[model samples]
Target: MGLRSALFAAQYDAAMRHAEHEELSSRRAALLSGLRGIVYDVGAGTGANLPYLPPSCRVTAVEPDPNMRKRLLARVGPANAVRVVDASAEALPANDASVDAVVFTLVLCSVPDQAAALAEAKRVLKPDGKLLFLEHVRDAGAHAAFQDMLRPVWSFAAQGCQLNRNTVAAISAAGFTVDERENFTVGPAWLPVNPMVRGRATPGG
Candidate 1:
């Protein structure tokens, strides 16, 4: 990665540290606690979820951005049982029904194709595997219009992160049934990425 990407990676932790401490950290711990088996942390930016994952599970932390991957690799220790892979959400280098769970933490917003990405997640998971996600979705109220208006500029500046995506619908459309979920806001009301959801889903009939 060049100067811009390197700069983004370097600033990422500091930029999000406040929110992580105030809200996201607890959410991550709750969602990942006791999770076991082979898990894939898709879009694993800087390995933020590594500390929360249970030690028994083997984790594949997939990140395509070299700058982000560099920071992510630094967090994976020998005892962490985590491996970093250079891959995008649309394609995973795993076999069919090969993993126990797939995770998406603040990831759906930036993927080029939501349906394809979720489909890939489903494809690599076992028939009984679970899907865990923590994402900011399209606002359901009037702010949705505001989200749409700001999306173009936001996506450009934030590395393709869309501010108004109905990600739960995309998850369902991709053939997963959400088993449990909690909807809440992470920051002040004025923040565009407010109104997030953390949940668990399994393959649907």
Candidate 2:
């Protein structure tokens, strides 16, 4: 990697590592239940979700950054029974109709192409498969406008994490419908940015 790329990786690793454990843990708790068969976590940074997931469920965590993958390996233990792979959401390596479920936790905001990524998730899912996720999305009311206004600057500083991605719409556009979901705040009013949306995708491959 070039100097800038190395620096960015280092910075991202540090930033994620510095994140509040409670913030991540709470969301993981809500999304990890009822998972069956193959579980694919998009942007499985540092494998924080590995510990909470049931041992019975087979897991394959997809992450692109080598630095993050290294951290993930260190965090995941033999008891968790996880398979961490070098991958990303925009394009998955699994064969068609192979995976039973795809998990997305705070992943879509950073994807360069949201539609392509969701399409990939849809393509790999079994006919009876489901899409599970917990994300921070554009909220209702003035908060939504605030997200829109701050998205450009936020995306730049955060390395492509847009603050205003219409996550619900994107999923629908990708051909999967939202079966259930919830939204809430993850940050204070000033920054007012932290939020979580959890649900399953429905009525599509």
TM-score of each: 0.96, 0.85
Task: Give me the runs in candidate 1 sitting further than 4 Å from their true place.
Answer: none
- Give the Cα error of residue 140 in candidate 1, in Å: 2.3
- How does candidate 1 score on lDDT? 0.91
Give stretches of model 2 more than 4 Å off. 1-24, 77-80, 189-195, 203-205
Which run of 10 residues does model 1 get worst, by summed lDDT? 1-10
Q: Give the TM-score of candidate 1.
A: 0.96
What C-alpha lDDT does candidate 2 achieve relative to the native structure?
A: 0.77
lDDT of 2 by residue, 1-205 (tens): 4454456655765565534464656667777876778878888876767766776788899988777677788888665578888887988989998988898877788888888999999989988888888777777688778888888877766657788778888899888978888776555644536555777886473
Q: 27-134 in candidate 1: lDDT tens per residue?
A: 999999988899999999999999899988989999999999989988896666688999999999899999999999999999899999999999999999999999
Q: Report every candidate's CA lDDT.
A: 0.91, 0.77
Error of 1 at 14 (Å): 0.6
State in Å the error of residue 23, model 1: 0.8
